[model samples]
Target: MSKIFEVPLYPYQRCADQDQATPVRHKVVVVGAGPVGLALAIDLAMQDVPVVVIDENDKVSWGSRAICFAKRPLEILDRLGCGDPMVDKGVVWNLGKVYFDERQVFGFNLLPEEGHKRPAFINLQQYYMEQYLVDRVRQLQAEGKPIELRGGNKVVEVTQDDERAELTISTPDGPYRVQADFAIACDGAASPIRTMMGLDFVGRVFEDNFLIADVVMEAKFPTERWFWFDPPFNRGQSALLHKQPDNVWRIDFQLGWDIDRAEELKPENIDRRLKAMLGDDISYELEWSSIYTFQCRRMDKFHQGRVIFAGDAAHQVSPFGARGANSGLQDTDNLAWKLKLVIDGKAPVTLLDSYDAERVHGADENILNSSRSTDFITPKSEISRIFRDAVLDLSERYEATRPMVNSGRLSVPCTYDGSPLNGDDCALMPARTRPGSPMVDAPVPGGWLLDRTGFGFQLMTIDENAPEALDVDGIEVKRLALTTPGDADGYLKQRYLGDANSAVYLVRPDQHVAARWDHYDEAAVKAALLKAIGR
Candidate 1:
């Protein structure tokens, strides 16, 4: 098939003929060139691993979906060396205001503390994010790295055995086959890979449809997030206004399930509502608009043989808390390192199973949290609505409940508690922070802290009984004392030890604590490390 679009061909495609006989293969094959897929490709390539990324789209879509970027994802991008560019271009927001009957019921700050390495969230269009990742991937490919981007190529079939995955991709020319050590499906929620594998995507699909519009407005609006419940212009409807780059704003209107999808999205209908909501004096130009039905679903399993699922393919949550893309990117961040470990022979193949287990748990939790927020925002029954309204009224009198009223639940970092990689004792304790179970940030000597830094096995020990040095080849051991007496014990009190004592904590690259011992035994620590890393 001849090229029908004006999009430029990826550099890898330019020399297709010369390498036709070589039979393209890579350490990993990533399907779909969305933000998550591209990010994973670049990250693995940065680690000196070969990656080949394929996408059906010739160019990035112009639609403005997924405009919110969360803190965890930004941290992942920072590891890839692209976080600063994104943070520079996007608007950082911390405060969110919730309204009931046009009255401000409560307000909360997203970034509770400012001096941290990353912010709470950023506002940027999905298209721009994809472009940024694509650009970086291309740059890495140009440097003679093992990163390749193939556009207008779609995966038609996948066959995976215990060792490697074979993919039959349909390119513009015709169908071709490629082999890789592993396959990652970053395709969207309606992933054909997941369906082809006969995996069950079980969850609820809400009846209400949401209308999203990105408009260029001249009116002055606060940089903070604004939400309206039961507004005068649209009764029984909730509207959200979020600031975006270039004076553009993202607006969402809850159109009940009964309305016709086509009619509700018409320019006339949207213009009428905007006029009523903002008054006649406000002027704005519509940039893009679309209507969508939200769903909360997760695949029965994140892996089938050597083929793995990441991002939306593994799970999908409602956009209420902006968990959709955030969760997907986090999946990539978790899976990339594990795959590298297995390919490099640093760990056993069993380590890959932990990726599926840990990420699936994260996806399930995100679905539950986002679903609960959606239920509170759009109650189905009259009784539920009354209860919600009463709660909002009660919150006005009680200052302690204001945070809950503003946002149902804060987007907390996730943890892998019951995984086989985690020790029995490690799974029994709770986190110090609300979502603190994932990784502990405790004080150490010389103003340097011990945390999960890269994709590999890690062990942090402060016990004097622990071995003075580590003998493991691929493991990193840090021995440091907490500078502040109360700080270290306060951080790990609930999670590891009930009392302040010298202890050793084994952590995975994904930031999950694997094992902890109050008094370190060299043999026991070695066994835990081998087990956690699947050596």
Candidate 2:
């Protein structure tokens, strides 16, 4: 086996320095500077780790791509020092309205006041998000950080051994070879690195194609999300209306599998659909439009030796639940901390394997959830449509079943149950909040309450009676006084727990709970930390 650490760059050399004749080598080389790749670069650079991110595109694409941003992703961007600007420019939506035909069936307030904090969702275009990331990368570069963004450069080949991975790239100047301790592929669904390595991207592709159009309209629509079932334009079709930042609306229409992609993408067809959906009296201009076939697939493995995969390279989900980009960001969040530990020599090589295990788990869960949501929204057969319509119709009478009928659970954060990072005895309990869990609002002492700060790891210990007994290095621990009526009762009820003030919750960097203990014990805290960091 090859050694784990190696110095690929020379002592007197600089990386991709425009004036240097010698090729540049970095500590890590990330292929594809999309959102996921850019995020990974920013996080690593903030930790003083050297990274080179290469993208084939000359600039960010301002297409009608991803527009919905979840709360978790917003928090991740905030930690990278870009979230405030993003939130400032983007719109925050808490309610989503679901419609059947022309009537509204149910409306849900996503950010219901559980204990504290706003809803877990936001709306922002992919292009704007990328622009913000690019600005941050440039700022870091100006500050002499060891992170580089090489535009108009494509990775042609990747060869990895045990210690390092070498990338051969085709740039404007000529072909060049760059070596790094690790290579991360964030190169979308058609990842060249993943194909070159012969990894399996396993899942089924849907038959229906979707037409997404971004337009600036004159009419005022409600800020809430609107999903129309069985819209009139195309019978048995579904349409989605979402408000963008500047009076722009994102509309998606489900086109049957038989339609020709090239002909249907013409300006006439797009304009016709828009007119039918938003009346001819409304004045609007088309900004961007595209037709794409959705897929529900994930790479069998996220890692192969020194080369790893993130974002669409590892998984692809239907756009119904907006899981594709959100899950990609989650992948970066999980891998960033682990890579930091390994680069700082604070952990072993075996710790890196957990990235594959943990991220793959998230990717699979995202795929499953997205696929299920897509099936419900766009039923394939007549029988499925009939059953779905029946449920929507029946939901009108059954007031108690409205929540389940309009299941928005897809937007919920994913959890890791079977990973070696979780507690061994966590399965024995029936509590709703457990180790390796996603963070949710809960009550605490002094009526102050306890909620995730949307930053790094948070350790909440309810044992205010004995706060001195539990302490851990490199981890932030908060002691909450478990007193008062709302303190213990509200916390337990919010987390759906019958009992109160019995445990400590350890949350990960991504706002997911890592481990929980019923009693304040040092051994349990240490084990939870070790399992959480994959020690």
The model with the greatest TM-score is 1
Clashing pairs in 1: none
The true-structure Cα RMSD of candidate 1 reads 4.2
RMSD (CA, Å), each prediction: 4.2, 6.6
Off by over 4 Å in 1: 1-23, 142-144, 400-410, 424-430, 433-436, 440-452, 461-482, 485-503, 517-520
lDDT of 2 by residue, 10-97 (tens): 1122235434465455688889878899999998988788998888775665574778888767767767878877888787888887
Q: Which 10-residue window in model 2 sums to the lowest lDDT?
A: 1-10
What's the residue-level lDDT of 414 in candidate 2? 66
